[model samples]
Target: MGRMMLKNWLALLTAVFIGLSLAVISIVPPSPQGLDTPDDQFSSARAMVDVRMIAAAPHPTGSEENAKVRTYLAGQLTALGMDVDISASTLPEKALARLNRWSGQSKTEQPIYNVIGVLPGADRTKPALLLMAHHDTVWASPGSADDTVGIASILEIVRAVNETGQPARDLIVLFTDGEEVGLSGARHFFSENPLRNKVGAVINFEARGGGGTANLFQTSEGNGDAARLFARAVRQPSGNSAATYIYRILPNDTDLTPALKGDYAAYNIANIGKAEYYHSPKIDADALSESTVQHMGSQGLDLTRALLSADGFPRKKPDATFFDLFGLWTVIYAPVWGWAFLGVTLLCYILPLRRDMLRKDTLVGAVKMVGFMVIGGVVLFGLNALSGGGSGADYYDRLAAIPRLEAVAGLTIFAVFFGTFGRSQLSENGVLGATLPLFILAVAGQSIAPTATYFISLTVLLCAIATFIRRSKQTETYGQWISAAVAAILIGYMVSFGHLLMLGVGPDLPSVAILPAALAVLAILPLWRGLPKRVVTVASIASLGLAIAIALWIRLDPIASTVPLY
Candidate 1:
């Protein structure tokens, strides 16, 4: 969009975005009980160990491993004097019989066992708090971090409270199975073994990644008594300053949310349920790989740290207004990046394609440069198998390791620039002929596919085009444009792969500055004689680039600890 249209769009979107953001903000489940010092009964951080050890009692999932865990928990809970139940998904004869017995009764079917331990409380009529932690881990990796942590936490808490002779309501410790594969254990338990009315609440301990700050929220959407409990159960100022309480409701639900929300959202659907936390930690078994977070890190936060961290945390906005305002900017400007790209392409197409507009030196240089680039492409192909795809950070690692790349790249760039700086008789065929390499790269299929080599070749070809334009421009000597071109590519490196190198994402790179710097260098004709050509040709590209970078930076970094957000 042009300046006028962009201005209008931003203004309109800002208003709508703010309004919707406010609406979303209001829907999160509010902690009703409010933050209370855990010293009153429960502690700030509790570990569930014994019941976890007990719940590891029977391996109903049929795997010898899961059975071992089940056997461990059952023995532990039985020792605690609570009733124990077992179910298995192992396609075992007994588990099959159990499933066959209940076939027509409910839609949910999973072999699971329930281990319950009761700790008598002060008031018998008071609702019993259901303490829960899943005993299951993913299929491969040890669930130690994903939830051995959670299970152990629950068991320890129950042990402490029970041993202390605490007075209050009863505590029903639940060691759930099949939590890794699905909420199979919990679902079947709830369906088959409905709780008594005295069961007032449930506390599920789930882990995301490495343990840092634990985010708490109600499984039910909208509002409920559970919301109040969360508000109260959460201690203030929290343990980790870096910790973020993602206690706001998003627009969707996870596995556990459906059952809870179905019962809970029944209370306040009109309010359009919201939440601050859901199970979002990445466990190894959930098909997560280092590459999963690494690749997605391109489009998201430090999910690895978020999931795995036990000490660091997600910080909440000091005021809700910040999120509202920032979310508005994101909603409004997200599309503008694509629009900016399209507008530039259209302008490029519309502008008069004039061969005469090119300088004499530029034409000659283009020819030589294109020739060298063709040679480079063939060489790149010949050496193809040496490099792998996925464009992993490994390339950067190896590139940095090689001192030759910097020296060779620098020398080659200069040589090409000097070689193409000038030539007198520039025929149409010769000039058009020079673009063959560039045409191939620009028009090729997406890179990073089976055609990665082709993509690399294309990138080299584009570099040639940059050289052609750089050589043809008479404003500054080829040296200046060449340096700028090199710098532009460096700047591109920072943008395309910059986030990875930053250590991790946060504000530092203005993003805007990168493009303007690169463009000022590449668009050398702007400073030379062809003023109109520079404006329409060079400046057009430069200005458009600057505009895009600014819009994206604004959208991405609306609120900052560094710059004045306004």
Candidate 2:
């Protein structure tokens, strides 16, 4: 019994280490490139020069500092051989009122200047490709990561493009003003600027935090052609259809929001790590992550070059389901493929079931899994509330608490998993039964929201395959290893996806993590050997205690020092 327990512990540790390593690798941004990088390459060192200047201080729209940023950007564009103009326009009445309210001023007139630069191509008749970033900052924030990084990336991209010679079509650089206030500058340009007619494609850079991998989070509707183009062009891409689908339903908006009104293929890219730094006054050029800038610029440069060299822009087609596999490469397919995956999953699960496997154990397992999700979700919600979630919570303060909140969620999840399932050695029937709920969910998701349901279907499919492999080779050592390998892949993806979800909405809805945690648990259920009751109880208690402690710390802690005074 002692030897058996030791082997079980070793196997569990090995699987965990492999999964964690993969998760870290998948989420970590690339190393920053130095100024010594080739002129034709996108270097964060080169881009940081622009970031230092643009984000030296807050430059909200209508501020004097904004004028300085606009002028400096126009000059940079001109030096890169582009024709530059400052398109000045009055802020809309509603926008001006909001600004006044925030500033405690009653000014009736405020002007926003959009810096427009045109780099003519060999054939001017071709539709132009626009690279966009805002030049404005929120109040009290130096805004290095928010907009400066984006602006700097575009400058670096243009310099790199110039080094490679003229593009096939015109390249338009748009540094919009008033993005933080209400996207006033973008609204003006997309609505009234005649150049809008010339734009066939747009790549807008944005940031929500100081660091992390930049993901192509949003694309125009009917993004099949556009997504494929991105997959083909980007060497190190980070994105998925799930993100686009979720963002489409969310109430959030970027400058891309207005541009979507135009008939153009659009991509909205942003990094969302170090989420606490978002809109924080402490965020400055020095606080920003150079690797994040490099990641953004490198991906942007690759996609821009591809678009510039293409014969025509991507046309409207049904959106495709896609995701990057550990940031190595993208896997794209039609939404209909989800149904096929489900069909295969059903086959894998059904093929191995015996008459005895269809008994009460299976029902118990299904009930256990359902209970895991419900109890875990409720615990997460309760913990988030303890950490000052819900109404009247300070938005920026919650953003700042993300790292700690992630820890609390993670610890609580471990506690829930152990408390619920760690004490039992599930039967084959029980393991298969556990997957039924998620499988049903995948089917419903496929029927209603196919694009976002790939992860669900893929998770269930992988779990089913692992179950079949384990049952077929019940006594084989290699079978355990194969199942472990499959578990590692699923767990790694769930970890990374959970991190992203936490960054995106954990501040208010950390309970959402229960879905990924449950999925990951399903993958590991087959390998689980019942732990001693005392051990399981101790682990669950310790983890839950730590999570509760963290929640209390977050609740009692003062608002972040970096938070804007307003």
Candidate 3:
């Protein structure tokens, strides 16, 4: 018995290590490159980038704050003494008429404008490589991030070329309006575009939710002809972040999308239906990729994709979020998921579900161990929360505030035991045995100091383990499974909402697995306990089939994923 206890304890240790390991990996901020610092290391490229920043200052067209951005772009273009053409191409008639037809509604949408500056080439009729940026933003807060930066970038590049008094393929810098409002500016521009035939290529810049996690992945479809040229010419060693770099091609949504065409259908198409979007990392993690589109479209270009992102994951630091987990935020759902996992093991003991090597009594003890483990965690959490000058935020926030995943690892340990404890049946001894492992996971994440959400989840899962240990049979009834099912549905239904709420898997995979399994278990319980075997079995199977079929449909058949920008 002592040896068996030791083995389970070891397994618990393994799980804690795995969970905390990932947590640590996430908080690892990469070493900042001494790239182009103004003091001494500033390279010519750095100088160019900095100068560009000053020239493009604030061209946001969405709100009053961003209005300054637009004024700045105009001012910069005027200062350069170039032939500037401000094309009111965004809110043109035909596009709005079509938008009204598509959204199944209509209103006098804003007139989209494009600030077009043409610098004629030597033998000028060749389509020029136009530079583009949307003069708009996500919120009324400030367009400084999403596009003020992009607009400013265009101004610097265009102005620099103008200063040389030599045009590179007839530079046409278009500071587009209504880019947020459904590529109205772009769609309007293309409606009768000479630039389409003449423009050889384009360089479009985009700002995410934040500033400066510098990266530039190719966002165009034309292989990489001009893109490689720019990258090679603009070559400077990229910034390094110590953690995972989530640099996959985001399907069209950012301001760059309008320009890219498939990406803006504007930016993409303007670059002749194929172009690249210069991007940064900050926006991807928390906010504003879609806000730019949604905010614009809501004024009624009917922005959808950029209004709402594709993966719907918690991205750029959004304006506000509902991922508010009060007390049991962190650990609450982990167990909800963990219970499914725990049930798999416990089936060996109760359902005679599967043949496994782990002893039945040990499994039962593990399920029952939540109480002892959580009690220990409560004390630890209280002390740590107290000791750390705990903010009015979750563990993830505090951890992130402190900025290290390892700092919050201890809390994660607490949640991990919540998992093992959920699997084991309640027993006084079992609770005692589970305490140490739970403490370990919590301690690990706590050590890393995760983001507010991460730590909160960690804490909730820890408490859940404790609750399980104390309750002994939380899942003993059909009502419990029904409750679990409801929770799963709500959480799963909102996966696309992302950080707007804390329920991620609550909306996707867990709900997929849980909703049906929960319903089936609830429906079949009466039969398994003594109802007519045939009647119960048939009803259970039908219910399972229906539930799963619905889940499959939701997963497979996407309703409004690809929205038409035109």
Please give, for residues 1-566, the per-residue lDDT of candidate 3 as tens digits: 46644544444344334433432322221232233323222122322343344323322233343455455556667776657766654355664565456445574764455777776666565445566667654322233444554554444344434444464346567777766556666665655566655654455555433322223333344222322222223222111110001122224454444344532212221110000111221222122232222111111111111111112211222111112121011111221333343333233223322233244553454333443334433433433343342444232222222211112222332232333332323332332233224334444433342212232223224333433433345544433333233233223322212211111111211212222222212211111112244554555445434433433333243322111122
TM-score of 3: 0.38
Candidate 1 achieves a global lDDT of 0.35
- How many backbone clashes does every candidate have? 60, 0, 95
- What lDDT does each candidate get? 0.35, 0.91, 0.35
Better of 2 and 3 by TM-score: 2
Query: In candidate 1, what are the lDDT values of residues 383-491, reduced to their tens digit?
Result: 2222221234233222221222222222332232222322222333333334433343433422212111222232333334444443454532443344344334333
TM-score of each: 0.36, 0.98, 0.38
Better of 1 and 2 by TM-score: 2
Model 2, residue 36: displacement in angstroms? 1.1
* lDDT accuracy of residue 544 in candidate 3: 37
Leading candidate by TM-score: 2
Q: Where's the lowest-lDDT run of ten residues in candidate 3?
A: 269-278
